[model samples]
Target: MLLIGGSVLVGVFTFIYARLVCTFICSLPPAVLARTVGVLTLFHIVLRELLLRFSPLQGERSTPARRAWLLSVVSWSLTGLLAIVIHVTRYPAFPAPSHLKFAVGYWALGGGLLAQVEYLLFERALPPTPTLSPEAQLRERLGRRLIEGYVIFTSVPVLVLMLTLQRFIYELHGDLRYLLEAVVLAAGFTGGALAVAIAYGRSLRRDSEQLLEAVRRVGGGDFQPGAVTSRPDELSLVAAGINEMAGGLQLRERIREAFGRFVSPQVATEFIEKYARHGKTAVLGGSRRNVVVLFSDLRDFTRLSESLEPEVLIEVLNGYFQEMVGAIQRHGGLVDKFIGDAVLAVFGLTEGQGDPAIAAVSASLEMRRRLEAYNARLAERGLHLNSGIGIHAGEAVAGYLGSTDRLEFTVIGHTVNVASRIEGQAREPRPPLLFSEEVARRLGDAFTVKEVDTVALKGVAGEMRLLTVEGEARSVRAA
Candidate 1:
């Protein structure tokens, strides 16, 4: 459809130019005029076919080249010029100035319109390409288009008018005054055209700067959309693209925040980063690594739930978890999951020099301190809560677990079972927090610990000794 439409359009313009020049301007015979139009139209159709057949274009970069249009226009204009040369060679009286002016104007206007229409038709026919980045689109160079348009529309017409006037003056044997007036008029026209071109160029430069600034802001983590112009050009498209990109980034951040509430923020961040780096192929799999697991549970939660209303029970539980989780996070621990009235957290998920056991112990102490502050606030409502925490450091399989539809990042091994049993032994008489012997081995002398008790934990061969953190050793204590 595009090829046929473009060919017919080009043929129609060729016939019109031929009729105007041969019949109206030169008064050629009808038979000769038909032959001239047929030859010119056929020549153009052949050239257009060749251009279509071999042209290589892909995606947006396939927009018709300026050189292709220029070649078509020049070929048609040269054919017309050759016909004129032949006519003048055969009939010496045909060398008229009026004829030359008409020919030049026809080639400049008519031929340009034909080439432009052909370009538009081809552009409409091309298949759409995927959206390219702003950087890629900027490489298309709109500046070059601006310069080419200025030369074609501004310079060419002015040059033709000046030449026509010069020829008329010479033919009439006019004085130097007429030539000077022509020169002045041409200069004025040139200057005005130049000023307009400069203003348009500056506007383009400003728009380009705005695009660059928007790209910089997006790169700097500002996901707010930028201002877009109403201009009907590639710059407008680029601005729209930037706005879309910003909106996508902003949505991703929102997803991350919501996801963090469902899981550890560190885990959520890692998930997002993997998605960004590996896209759909990214997977969360288990890894065996040494880590410290902490388990904390509100003591006598069943009796407390029976006493308070469901809403009040939930409120108290949320407040407790918030304080405990804050303490854990401050010590570089990840709150893995919440199990009803129990809270499970992991440290050393991200490997570092600091001992995960020390962080787990410090977090338990902070949890104890934060709990005191929380109970004071709860005293106004005639309510109090107590929680026991257990820490154990050992190798465990840590990663996403569960069915394909749903998964949770957590640690699983005998170490986790030992931590839970140790917390169970932390009754009223003993300290509210306890740790396994494995944790004590990692504690060194940094913290003062005492043998709490021995308890046979489930899935373990023998009884594991429990220890309670009293305080930091005097040598390492703050003054």
Candidate 2:
């Protein structure tokens, strides 16, 4: 609409100027001038519409090189036809027909130059072309160069034709003014084209720098989405994709936080590593591993719960479990599960450390020391509590268990059951820590332990020997 309105205003101004001030130079009547302006305006509009329909600048079709070539040919043909029409038409008062022909040629040259600039702008704004292959990238670069070359090559011929006509005019009239005017006009057009090219190059360089900085931030694990430009162009799409990727990483970090709360850190890390390496199938199977199982239970917890208020009991139990779990974790043990006031822990589930049975024994001795200190705090409130621990070493089938919907990674065998029974034996009038003969043999006199009576535990085929560590439950000075 702007183009059409501007053309109409120019045509009206030309009609008025030719009728009033330029009557000597332009002898054409007002009606003829008006008809000529209207025809030329309509021709310009039709030429532009045809160029848009066939040009790759519109982005409606593929094979941009072919389409661009076709548009260039049609544009030059139309320009030549317009120039010929101007040359053939007779204006009796006009000094020379070459002046009018030069004007037509100049208009066509300016339009072609402007069209090239517009096509470059449109190409820069287009979405990223897929250039995954080296050949595709080379082709894209070559195509851009070809288009630019075509624009420059086509413009040179038009300028040459216009200059040749001006030379003809000068030869007929013996004037030097036409040559000077042509030189000045060509210089102005060249300078303007250079300025436009430089501005476009600067803008492209700035956008590319911003994109590189954004990519660097993403690489450093900074997932905060940066401010993006509002332009509806290829750079805007790239910024949007980067922001989406950062959002996904933020969500993954949140999931990791929540997952850590549901399982031990060792289990969580192992599970994630295995899942990454072998997908979901990694956790489906089980293996028989030689591990040390430990179980601990608060003594007389049912009767004590009956005495204390629910809130107080909960507070006391939480504190006790926190200290015990910390001691176990410090000595390289994984707390498998907590059943009310009881804890089931295992060592050597994933990585085999040096003497897992010794580690379990060390953790148990630490727990006994922690409990004694805990009892002193209880003594302040006119309350007393004790705990029992049992340790055993054997081979157990350890892996993820339960249904697909809900799974648990744990050890399942007679060894775990025996550990539980040994914990029950702590209720007798003996040391509060006990272990099977298997664990005692593995220790090899690391600490003094006395063998207890051989008795058949439930579900066991024969009598199993047990041992209790001396001085484990003895009171020590609080530090």
Candidate 3:
């Protein structure tokens, strides 16, 4: 539809131009002029169609200026040749004057200049290709600007040259009437050219403004996809790129949230930095580290689960875990895993500013405090809960373990086993918190602990001394 409309418009303009030149300037007969106009119009239409059909400036890498120049030269050259042939053949006896020939040549030159301007406008309206990189797209835009500048610069001089030639021809022939006609023609052509240039410039400006606004919105974190334009242009590619970038950021945020649920933020950050720097998996194999491990188990949880409704039991367990995990995390510990009603946490797995044993002891105290507060709340509802915690500090092998499809991060060795066994000794009538002799020594004067007894643990070489942490007294009668 667009091509047809442009062709029709170009044909009409060419016909009018041909008739005006033949009637006022060439002084050709009516029949000859009519035939000439018809020929010119037909040729104009055919050339326009061909140019549109096989446009060179349709791809990312095409030279738009060169294409426009070629179209202008061909269209105007054909017009000049056809006009001269028709005039000479129709009036063989009365040859056209030299001034008329010069006028025709100058007029054709002006038409060619106008055609170049129109070609430039058409190229500017074309949408940008998406496959081009940003740098390539920028270069293309700069090239277009240079072409538009060339057209404008050359257009002014050409129009002036045509007007100067017409004035000289009229003066040489001493025809005042023809000179007035020449002035009128020059004004009309100049006005029309200015109008076209102004309109094209305004349209280009509007599109540029829209693209700049869209870029600003994206920079400000507005991920809302812009309205897609029907034109296949550079602006559309920019909008698509912005939408893709925003989607990637949103996905990354969701993944970070999920990761935080399973590991401490510090550990997660360490893993990310390590992966970024080394490009190697950090959790695939065990590394021996002096880490403080803490294990907490709810006393008689099996009996509690049997007595309570399933929903109520789950609610209580979630609430208890939330409080306990909060304490562990607050003291720089990672909650490794939850087994039934027991939680295993590790400290000093990553770099820490303070002693890991001290952090573990502080976390255990906080857990007891939180548990007391939680029990007070449960007591109002005629329900209660109790838990025991055991802390141990030693070298342990910690890393990911499991099948290729599934993996679990945990610490293992004598340290972990001893911590779990110590938790088992925290039954009714005993202090709800116990630690190995190593943890007590590491605590120094930071905590008050008493030696409980020397007892041999399963799969251990000798009897190990255990100590019970003592501080703010609390009721553990429920255990």
Candidate 4:
């Protein structure tokens, strides 16, 4: 229906153009014949549209080039057929010589104009098709659009004026004055067209540079919005799309930073990467895996908090946690969470070059060293503190846990509980760091470990052997 309506409008405009500009005497029969030919052309176009729409071979194969080629064929075919019919049937019998030249040129101009209008209508009727393959070069397509604009807006009108003046020259018996008027009109139109084209080209180049810079900034992790002013054309749509992409990236960055604050940055990064890789949210569940868990607590933290003001207590805790958490992360441990002045970290969830047991023990030793430095700083403030760390390696359930709205990635099981119980045993005569029999076994000859004692832990069925690191093995120390 759109095609039919648009065709009818084109025919009406063509009729008016011919009558006002051609000024040729025509019998009713030729007019009726031209209308009949137009009706036939419309029918042909409609038939082609219907066949293409319902063709079994029509899948997702339509392309812009194919559509443009098709529109060109249809438009020019109608133009040529109508011009041939008008010239062969009406012009040969016309009496005046000037009328023949005038009518033929006017008809050719009208036919060319008709072809342009039909091409536009056909293009609208057949919109671009979606395909999985990459499209053609956008730059090439935009360049083609600029050329089309020049032909339609500048070249077509100039041709029409030239034809009109040529007919006037023939009518006035080769008048030089009308020829001069033609030259002046051509010059003025040419200058205006050049100026318009230059302005349009400059605007297009500026917008294209802005879009490229926007993409470059986004790639460099700058997610700031771009300032690209574009006319209401393809450039405007491209600008809007780039702005939306930048906004989405900026939002994701904010989410990542917020999530990292709640959990370890390593865990947060893994969660996001998994989401992207699987193209869906991760399932809420846990898996049993062999891992090493480390637990550290400040001794007499409750008593110290009671002695200091709230602000001072918070400051001390923050300072202590910063040191301990940094030590854990340096050894590839995930800082699970903090309980009051206690820190819980896990290893082996993420694959790394070092063994999980060795990494946990190494982190514990580093925490001892960092705590001594922290103690020196506290001593300067007329205060001092101490902490105990326990490490254990065993099978535990590790994954995200909690309600859908509030989930936390952590480890939970007997392994974690045993590590916490073992930390309670670290006191005055013993080293501030201790580990279970399992951790010692995994360390093997990597570090010199001494059996501390066999102690019964709370809620455990039997007594468990604990060990403390004396020093690294000779080979490890040499390395």
Error of 2 at 125 (Å): 29
RMSD each, Å: 10.1, 14.7, 14.1, 8.1
- Cα lDDT tens digits for candidate 4, 1-479: 65455445545554555455554533435576467547645654665566446543223444454454455445444543554555556566653432333233223433345445555664566555454232232333344456555655566567666666776776445786877888788888787877777677667766776777777788888888574766877778888888888888888778888988889988888888887435786678799999999999989887898899999989988998889989899989999999988999999988863899888888887788888899899997888888898989999999989876778888999999999999999877777888999998998878888989899999888999989988645423622
Scanning candidate 4 in windows of ten residues, the lowest lDDT window is 132-141
Clashing pairs in 1: none
Clashing pairs in 3: 127-233, 128-233, 128-234
Q: What are the per-residue Cα lDDT tens digits for candidate 3 across 1-479?
A: 44334434544554555455433434656575556556665676577557756866544564454455456556656655666666566566543542245223423433444555565665666555565455445444554554465555655565555555554565355556666776677677766876676565555555555665666676676756473434568767765776677676556556666777777666556655666346675457678999999999998888999999999999999999999999988888889889999999999987754789888888888898899999999997788898899888899998767765576667889899989998887776667888899998987867667898788888767998888766544212111
| lDDT of every predicted structure (CA atoms) | 0.72, 0.68, 0.69, 0.72
Q: How far in Å is the alpha carbon of 362 misplaced in model 3?
A: 2.3
313: Cα error in model 1, Å: 0.4
- Model 1 off-target regions past 4 Å? 1-182, 276-278, 281-284, 351-353, 472-479
Candidate No. with top lDDT = 1
Assess candidate 2 and give its lDDT: 0.68
Overall local distance difference test of candidate 4: 0.72
Looking at candidate 1, the ten consecutive residues that score lowest on lDDT are 470-479
